[model samples]
Target: MSGTAGHGTVKGRDFRLFWFGETVSLLGNGIAVVALPFVAVLTLHAGTFVVGLLTSVAYLPWLLLGLPAGAWVDRLPRRPVMLVSDAVSFVAFVSVPIAACAHVLTIPHLLAAAFICGCASVFFTTAQRAYLPTLLSDAELLSGNARLQGSESTAEVIGPGLAGMLVQAFGAVAGLLANALSFLVSWISLRAIRVTEPPPSPPPEVRRRRLRTEVRDGLRFLFRDRILRTLAVFSAVSNIALTGMSSIEVAFLVRTVGAGEAVVGAVLTLCGLGGVLGVLVSHQVSRRYGSARAVVICLCGAAPFTLLFPLTGPGAGLAFFVVGGVGVGAGVVAANIITDTFRQRYCPPDLIGRVSASAAVISFGAIAVGGLLGGVLGELSGVRETMWMMTGMYTLATVALVCSPIRKLRDFPESDESLRAAEAEKAVP
Candidate 1:
């Protein structure tokens, strides 16, 4: 792979199809990001705490089901897991429109709906972590993750803007219908992809012993791996801050900055574009300066900028959007590449899902706390002060990583054979 943004070399055929499926699915997810709160607050008339809870509901499944989901994903057929998960999300989202049409949509019902969809997302994500490695070799992971991050960033930029306009134009309930349709589309796309995974080696004759052993083994290994431990810590602390920022985004734009929903959507979308650019360029940047260097630069520089969001002028909104997006994109790419590359290299094939889920549970669980704290911070300090504090949160994320040996990782995957040999070695002893 020459450049990031998926241009260097197209990866595995199965990966290509799988990537397309995920991209579409992410777009649908983006639609929900906009549609959910608006539906709760603007449509069903939810209070501030309720809105935060709605968001938290979406993340709760990760924390509650993480270990089990990971174990389950490891044991299942990934492609089918993906397809069925999307299908489940499809129905959960569609129910909103059906409920609204029937004039029966209410707060509790919506919460239940969001929780169900979130459950589906957990399965999809755990399966994805295991599935992606199967699609691309260690050599292609950087470019592959770049593409994935790029698509997500692009969706961040584009999807919300689209959601805002659609919600405003058609109403949030109607916009959700579009989101449902997007998931349906994603399901169809995944249905078409064919992948080949080496069958899992048979477990020992004792079933519960083997399963529980594998689960504990993954957790033990992840904690013992200095690199992954750092990644997990970095993910938790940084996400806590960022989630706080996310919690206050609407209030910051609407109350603090006095920008309307469309403006907020546009501003957020600009951040998305910056993220897309970061993802596209990160691979080359990693190659030129090294992945570890890129992570440090992004983490140190941009993470603090979250604090500066409230400090702006006329025509300055674009700068804020682009800079913030770039910071998020770059930091994420560096971290993911480092983590995925290492995990794929180090993790036993059987334990990938549990490790991935455990990591996510920690990260998203922090996000849940961050989002709640952000809401409280916004109400108490006002959006501007709260965001200024957000800058510190980003800084905290960097500091967490600063202590890690991975920070000095100057090169990636010394050699393919060597990388596999390392995995093989781990398997043997």
Candidate 2:
């Protein structure tokens, strides 16, 4: 009912619509997370490498198409891009069930579906991140991000267990069908939104720039800023380690930890519950501890608990993973809310798409590589050992944050006005 610029809490009608859509989409994706690999491993009898490849393929589009997608999103209406992405995902997901029902499903078909949906995500996520600023003012950005993260985490908490149940009761195909239906719900919610988006504004010279140049410009902008550069590198490295650990987690639980399918799903659900708790308190923690300091505390401080994961074994020892996961999930979510809010407030509106894309490219690319690495390492060193090694790598990645300028500051820089004032003061001498 209002323009793109609305001010208030996240409870506003416009923000609720966006949040609800994303929550359903995330829940669908969560179900598919378990369902997808199960289809390969159980139905098709694929191996570890193939299961890992499924994840790698889904994220590979971020590396290949991320830059161009960002520039394209900058030039288009974000909502339309999101709608098209949802439609693409819907079709891709729906195809899997159809093929399964017809008994024509093959690994190649699954891979193709994953790759196509991944490409859709590349466009959709870039647009959505860029579009959020349009929906809320700077002051509300933190609240908005926290609320969104909470909803997503809530979905994560429920999705996996549901997936496990559906897979057990009906089949993995049932989860895929649920995911397809979720996208339809998301599309409808997005269509019903009443906020009017402003027109895209590429300057004459910018419009004339080559696609390569535009992509390079986004990369340049991210690297030119010290804070953005540091965070980007940190996130990339962290993703590599996190993905490696996650890629093997299901296998580790089923084989090494000696847990059943339902148990594994429950453990992962606890991880999401931790994320929800983190989001619930993130705003207060940032206000109390200082957002900049909170990032360091949440990340570097909590990472060491990853050792708990490696200590996990059969029966009661498995609860170690639940505790470790809670720490990691809570810490990571809070830090993300702080950093994302900072990025939104600090970056220029026009460049937000490119900037967000540039960061996502590296981070998501690392996830792809990490997935492959996990598979290889699992084969070579054994799954439990690989988890230990990857956890160490993740813990070490936090060193980048400690070395960055952000470590020395109480609060991260805020607003273009504050940035300009600080620059002017520096030049006064």
Candidate 3:
């Protein structure tokens, strides 16, 4: 037997439906990466600032809604939350084509739609993360996460290119129809899944139902101990650096290195390939180096590569670009695993929504700042100089290992046994 009882490749009917639905939706989201910005800049004639607003607005819900939404996810039936969120996503996406056809699609309306969809995404994401461990057992988590990583990486490798081709052929408006359809598909799959989720625990009295208690409990759960706090802070900083780099990477490639779109795409595709490869090998790497130490070394190795990105010449950029890709693909898996472990072990089982919301908000908030600051620094100095600056920023991100014992440690949590220990400590008033 793998993890949960009744195991096969399909993992039973519910897992199959749940997995396929998310895979479909993620692929479509991959399409949105290319489509959303295209529509914002080309179709809507937005300026740089408007584009920034669109991107940042898409993230704001994580800041404002993550905790409350997570609490709500814990309180409600996870499947219904998943279904309704998908439906909301579908409706939000459908309006894009309708407005485009009417020639009534403005940047503000487009942003509005994106904001709505993004908010729903926060909800659906919280529920899905919470929903997963219940469906599998301890032994199967490795293989199950591998499947997820592979699916996500596969989507990354192919989705953007496909989106670009689709937009070029069909126009961005029509391409978004694919995203809308993906959401509808996900909704139907959710409807088919059979799981007996427990109802909320508390009575609907004013005291336990208050927003403050919910938010406070979530925060405490997310940061109550050494492990969770270290994981959260490190992950947040690393993601910020990644986002900051993205904001400026294209400009650097174009102006500093004189690279074309073809080169940029090719280099990123290589990184995506690295991600696919990384997921395949993550378990082995965790075993060999110990998960936390492996992640630490990966982060340290990647920091210096940031400098290589800015150094111009024919071969220099290519070498650094490839190195960065490998680092990123592997690093992403490391971060995902660490954070997921923290959530799974430390958070109250019933409070996945709120704790995840806290994590999401912190992570995404850093991303917004990183993107903004990257753009600002690039404008103030030069792109290459800005890239060099990030080398130090990223190095500082790794400094958390020094603050937390995870840096010196060399072990995975023995099992979900650690999860129980963490929970007992938390039950202490």
Index of the highest-lDDT prediction: 2
User: Candidate 3 on 1-429: residue-level lDDT in tens?
Assistant: 123643313366777788788888888877775567667656775444454455566666777787788778777767888888999999999999999998898887888887899899888888887777766765555566667777777776666666667766788776578889999999999898777666656566723568878888888876865666777787678776776666555455545676554554455556667567667766666778887676666666556655655564554547676677666666676546544653564455666677777888788767766766666676677666766776667778877655676776676455345756756887999
What are the lDDT scores of the predictions, listed in order? Answer: 0.72, 0.86, 0.70
Question: Tens digits of per-residue lDDT for model 2 on 1-429?
Answer: 232444526546777898889989989998888788878877888776777778888999999999999999999999999999999999999999999999999999999999999999999999999988777777677888888888777877888899888888898788899999999999998998888888797899989899888888889989988778888998988888888877777777877888877888888888778788789778888889898899998999668878888889988898889898888888898899899999888877888899899999998999888888888888788888888888888878887689888887688888646856876898996
Comparing 2 with 3 on lDDT, the higher-scoring candidate is: 2
Cα lDDT tens digits, model 1, 49-96, are 566677777788888877778877777777788788889988998999
Q: Rank the candidates by TM-score, best first.
A: 2, 1, 3
Q: Estimate each model's TM-score.
A: 0.88, 0.95, 0.86
Stretches > 4 Å off in candidate 1:
1-8, 11-13, 210-212, 312-322, 412-429
Q: Lowest summed lDDT over 10 consecutive residues: which window, candidate 3?
A: 1-10
Question: Once model 2 is optimally superposed onto the true structure by TM-score, how far is the C-alpha of residue 299 displaced, in angstroms?
Answer: 0.5
Residue-level error in angstroms, candidate 2, position 31: 1.2
